[model samples]
Target: MDFDQVRLHLNAYKENDQVIDAAKYLLYSFDLEHENFAGFGLRKAIPNLFLLITEGELGEPQKVMIPPNLFDFDLNLVLNVIAHEMLHVRQKSSINTVEDKNEREFQAYYEMLFHKVFPKIPNASDFHKKIFADKAFEYYRRMGENSELQQKYAAQKKEIEQLISILL
Candidate 1:
């Protein structure tokens, strides 16, 4: 879908140069056009976050929700947040299952933590770093301690790690 056509949804569609510029940059840098998304949308009243909305029989990604004020953040930070949500879009469309929420979070956060592209950005503030530490390492730390959850998710973790390598 054309990024220019991203729906304003409930938002009153005021023209924002920042959103337009960032959309252009994202289009150039990522494989967004072919994803199984219904479209992109803008939400004005919600928290300042991006979201991937899923639907249909398999719960695949249907649309990406962008807060209208998202572009007010630092550009790198804005891109990173959008990239994170896009990763969710990819995970939902490719995996087609809502199960393994932990695995999914792990994979996405792993990318944010270790991937070369994601790591060099200066916008990953301490708050984000804290979440990355707490959530991303939860399963790996458990496995190291011999938690049974380790056994439950071992193969899946390995698969996700491999996928992370590819995504990186």
Candidate 2:
């Protein structure tokens, strides 16, 4: 999917999904704030206060960054990537290390699952396919052996699964 297609789907989804709307607002706001910083020479004078104000429910990330080659990927792959990014927007944090990166990814996947962004897989026949469920742990190896992050990831995984179980 290309940028246009992503925007098309997002426009549709945004009609009913407030999450996307809020994300766009935060993203655009951040962009405008940054532009002002450069335009008005405020980059070092003061921090972006809107960012510091909304700390937990929303953090640093405002926009979803898309690569130049996203148009080459399959639609499902593209959607999965978008979902992953939206999750990051939903739960951004102060990323300062590799462990932080991995943990954030795990959290994004958990958020995706909880939000039902994952495509369903019913038959065991297609188990080997690169479906959302199959490729969920593709980034896990980077997590290393950090037991605390692992435990947090596992607990949240289970919690999200249980929540999914109840809702679905």
- Models 1 onward score TM values of 0.56, 0.39
Candidate 1 lDDT, tens digit per residue, 27-118?
44544443565556665545655443433333554566666566545554555555565556666775554355566566666555554434
Put down candidate 2 lDDT per residue, 18-133, tens digits, no spaces: 43343344334323222111111111113221111111233344444333333333443444445565445444534432226666667655544544433331112122122333
Q: Which stretches of candidate 1 lie over 4 Å from their true place?
A: 1-21, 30-34, 46-61, 94-98, 116-123, 138-168
In candidate 1, list every pair of residues with a backbone clash.
none
User: What is model 2's C-alpha RMSD?
Assistant: 12.5
Clashes of each: 0, 0
- lDDT (Cα atoms) of all candidates against the true structure: 0.52, 0.41
RMSD of each: 8.1, 12.5
